[model samples]
Target chain A: MNFINSDKIRKDFPILQRQVNGKPLIYFDNGATSQKPQQVIDVINRYYQHENSNIHRGIHTLSQEATNAYEKARTTVLQFINAKHNHEVIFTSGTTGSINLVASSFGKKHIHAGDEIIISTMEHHSNIVPWQMLCEEKKAILKVIPINDKGELLIDEFKKLLSPKTKLVAVTHVSNTLGTINPVKEIIKLAKTAGAFVLIDGAQAVPHTKVNVQELDCDFYAFSAHKMFGPTGVGILYGKEAILNELPPYQGGGDMIKTVTFEKTTYNELPHKFEAGTPNIVGGLGLAAAIDYMNNIGIANIEAYEHELLSYATEKIKKIEGVRIIGEAANKASVLSFLVDGTHPSDIGMIIDKLGIAIRTGHHCTEPLMNRFDIPGTARASFAFYNTKEEIDTFILALERALKMLL
Target chain B: MNSIKETQQEIVEEFALFDEWMDKYEHIIELGKDLPLIDKNYKTDENLIKGCQSKVWLHAELKASKIIFTADSDAIITKGIVGLVIRVFSNHTPQEIIDADLFFIDQIGLQEHLSPTRSNGLLSMLKQIRMYAIAFSTKADA
Candidate 1:
């Protein structure tokens, strides 16, 4: 595989130099939360030191400066997702909070007792629980589309699940557990025909791939900044203006107010309506800087490089005795999940960790999917553009040793 | 019940001696064994944690002005690990649970063994435990 600006990229992340268990850290948990680059960290530091204040109000100098940076971060997100307007971009705590906002706001208004909300079998609990709670509250039905044994969504099954009663279709763009990239655009198209709004959980897709909400025609898209090499407690929820306008506010507090009275409190317009309380100011600037970093490296290049890494890693991992790669879909993102014979995933992870090759083990926030597969969980080694082939070799060797030790 | 500071100090002392990763891990599993799993009859849907790789059962017991947590899992090692957590942090008042500053979790070298999802589960367990403690303490205070 062609090496990325990997050495240059490596220098930008100080945490990469960190040693865990007497070895240099090889963080494979990017799919969960990527380590931030120096650029993002520096941006955060610069913001706090130079421009720190509550945004959207105040005649003070820091307030205006903070407001500009925060709104600029929204614009950056708009450009990143190719959303039509900055107003559609809402800052949230993270992807889960964003999804919950939609479930609470949109689901509360748009759904009725008999209406159905369709999701796939391979959804994160964040996507599932919020909707389940909403469905339970509204007496609406929750429909799950089945995935193939290879972890690809059965489009036919999804189509069958669609009906006039289907109010919303929420699906993950990529499986955080299995690396399955669902045909989200097509799903959006089908759901649209059924008069259903679509929300794409891009938490797993945004860091590795390019997403255009307008081009994809998804009504709503949610992603976490931390997973894309930015700070924690920051995320983006991009919604079409029409849908966002139709939904109610998620939380009522400081910034979300347009005006307030004893009898009635008017909420703010799009974006601000959902962002209540003091938003993460430094985190916003950090996210903008992270977007800039991605712009330089190029998402297409990263996706291509990671595709090659996954194939290469998958090939070597498959050669190991009694190793089974999970989620073998025709189309997948960079993450690879697998299990070793006669060894628990936790056990395999423990040994591999000693070799300084970090990997995620267990259900990956999709226990229902795990139950579908009839396995507890798998050991997952997800690759980002910052990863190299040598890391893959180290990982394979660790797996071999772990297998021997466990056997 | 002991003051929150005293319990935290005790927890720190219990873990302060461990130097090796594997040794620390063994201690954690043993704590999981200490997890005072609630009664099987209590294993209703409410006690069940959704999205677990295995059947994990949990409940809390109030012991001498403190909340003691008992948990069990069908998965052997996971159950053992749960026991370890219970030994370290369970049976404390809400103030104590919150104040105990489980930050030692990272220093003791336990977070590395956990998967992100499993870590999520652990956080959920901790949250539930803390929430339980808060409820109990709120009642006691009220």
Candidate 2:
């Protein structure tokens, strides 16, 4: 594992130097979106400044340069996830867009009346709603895999739900709200046995850990660039080559067509068929730059350091009276979600912000999960590698101050 | 009750005394504790504000030609926000509410202090109060 020099890492992210509310900002909202490094920001700036052109259209030099840069970004993503082929990686707006693409394209083609689609209790609304819409349209059944009080998925219940009629299983690799790192390898194997294709929402996973799609053998992997320290508008939908070839195109537009006429229009091949229009070219390049930044730091190091931070934070936060840590799965990641007894998460979050501590306070786009816990929401302090032990201490102090003010 | 501007000015002066945001939020929470809660019957879906993270029900009634606002929120900070709104806009005529410029939020530094979403909720609360004012004004004119 490469050594993470956090001092250098902090400097790479310009936002880390900034202040909020007259105090130096302590950003802990990595679950919502990670802060971009200067490298990625510079890449975006350079793209717009120098290589700005419509890709794959004109025979001009600038267009060629743009096309190369955009496709190079695709290659970087392919290697980042260890995807088998180039054409399998489809660029979409974000994780939501990627999931919607699969649900619309794959669901329209394969899913039918009485077919069952399985998801989890802990999925973000982005993962849940698209499948729900697909089920509603196709007259299919949407099944949820229940979780234990610790917020871990009950594998027994999941096994019971899977059948020959199960068309697809969509689950998150990491729970955004709970911080549970799912046993996805086993889950994927089980779904395959039931002849169900699996789509893992890697939005929460890609930043903190290494993901190899071939080893997991998930049919589709969806994730957002913004969550992984890249620009907001770009994301990846990595489908198996054969499965992608079989699915229909998501949208019809200028770029996605092979030949167009009023009478007949032929769709373009694998990746381009899905990428319908002018893509977020700068965002794509920026995402690639982010991937490069992560690779240089080494994902293994990030995972280990983040694990330490989580453990340290958990222990410190657990010591506080009346403070209940929300998720306690055996396996977890960078998220530390909690609620202070008799105090609303928002009230806690507001007070903490005064101390320049940024934590997410809401349903986190997971209302059903909040409903399951019978709470309004949680104040989530998620971490990135650049975050220090000092910052965590400050967060703990701010939280204590907040509790004193509120309760 | 004081005039709307007077009430707003009073709130500004009150908030100005607290140098720390924690103290200001403490004052807000205290004000929340002092809120004139909406009647159980009026706490229906119709009175619930949409944008808040917590459930906030606000009921406005025209009593003696003045809009009397009562509210309740599940979240303390939001309740405080509702309390602040009620203190400014309540006990005023519909025309007064409709025309009143609510600059106290900015003056008290409450606008910058809240999260973007919370700010959105505050705006929604203010809008709902103004909406009630417009509706009552239409009725008064009719």
Candidate 3:
């Protein structure tokens, strides 16, 4: 097992050194978005300073350089997710954009009235809303797989929901609010048997664990860059080559067409068909730099370190009086969601903010999951590789102090 | 009932004693605990303020040409802030409410809650209060 030196890794991120509210910042909002490393920032800076040009359109040297860098970033993403081919990786605005692309294009091609789409109850709004819109448009049926009190999906109930009419199964690889690491391999296999395509919302998963699309055997995998220490407004969607070829272009414009005429226009091949406009060239480069930063630290080391932090925080939080953890899944990630006995989450969040500890306090864009648990929202502290056990200790102390005033 | 300016000055003075944010928050929480909550009948969905994090229910009625505002929030800090807002704006003429400039939130160093990104809906609550005042003032004219 590779051990991560988080203290050394912390130096790479400049934001970690800053203070908030006159105290050293203890950021536990990695699930929302991770802090960018200096390397990624530098790459973004270099792109604007030197290689600023439109990709795939200009014959100038700068354009060629920019295009090479952007395409190289796609290859980085392909290797990062262990994708089969380069064209299989498509750059979208974010995870939401990626899912929307698949939903719209796939729905246009295959879905019809009475078709069923299955999604788990723990899905984030990004994963849920796109499919709901698609279903509403195509007049298809939307089925939800239920979860137990511990926030684990009930496979038996999922099995019962599957049938020949099930067209697509969209689910999160990990619960953003609950920190539940779902069994996507099992889910994909089950969906395959039911003759439905699978699209894993890897927005939360790619940052925390090793995600091999081939191993998962899902038709589509979607994730965002910002959540994984890259620049915002960039994301990747990995689809099987054959499946991507079958789907129609999501949008029509420059760079997405092979040939355009007054008569008829044919769409470009593979990933370009999905990416319709001038892409975020710098964002793609920053994402590649972020991948390089992760490689340097070793993702396994980061995963193991974060798991330790999660366990430490969990055990300490359990000792706090009047605190109930919302998600206690047997297999969990680095997120800790909890509520005090008599205090509202926003109260705790507000109090702790004065102490310079930043944790997310709200429904976390998972209102249905909150409804399932019968709570308005939970205070969530999500850890990343740069976070230390000392930070967790400070967070717990801040939380305890906040609860004292609220209670 | 004190005038809006007097009530705002009094609350600001009270908050001034607490130099640290922790003490200010403690006072706010205490105020929340002692807040005269809105009536249960007014706690329906229609009266609920659209906050992303905390739920706030507000109700107002005119009595003897004065707007009596009662508000409650699920979150204690928000409730406490709401209590302060009510102290300044409640039991005043609708015209006074419509014309009152609320600078006490900044004076008390609680301006962060009023930020658009805070999502506690303190800004929205203030807007709702003004909306009520506007409606009642127009009704009085009629």
What's the ranking of the predictions by DockQ, best on top? 3, 2, 1
Sliding window of 10 residues with minimal summed lDDT for model 3 chain A: A1-10
TM-score of 3: 0.99
Listed models, DockQ each: 0.16, 0.67, 0.92
Which pairs of residues have clashing backbones in candidate 3? none
Candidate RMSDs in order? 7.2, 1.9, 1.0
- Relative to the unseen true structure, what is the C-alpha lDDT of residue A299 in candidate 1, on a scale of 0 to 100? 88
Candidate 1 regions exceeding 4 Å error are: A1-3, B1-142
Fraction of native contacts under 8 Å reproduced by each candidate = 0.18, 0.68, 0.93
lDDT of 3 at A117: 96
True interface contacts retained by model 1? 0.18
Chain B TM-score for each model? 0.69, 0.90, 0.97
| Model 3's interface RMSD | 0.5
Q: Tell me each candidate's TM-score.
A: 0.79, 0.96, 0.99
Predicted model with the maximum lDDT? 3
The best candidate in terms of TM-score: 3
- How would you encode candidate 1's per-residue C-alpha lDDT over B32-112 as one tens digit per residue? 445556677877778876434445667887788788777766544566556656766766667777666665456545664
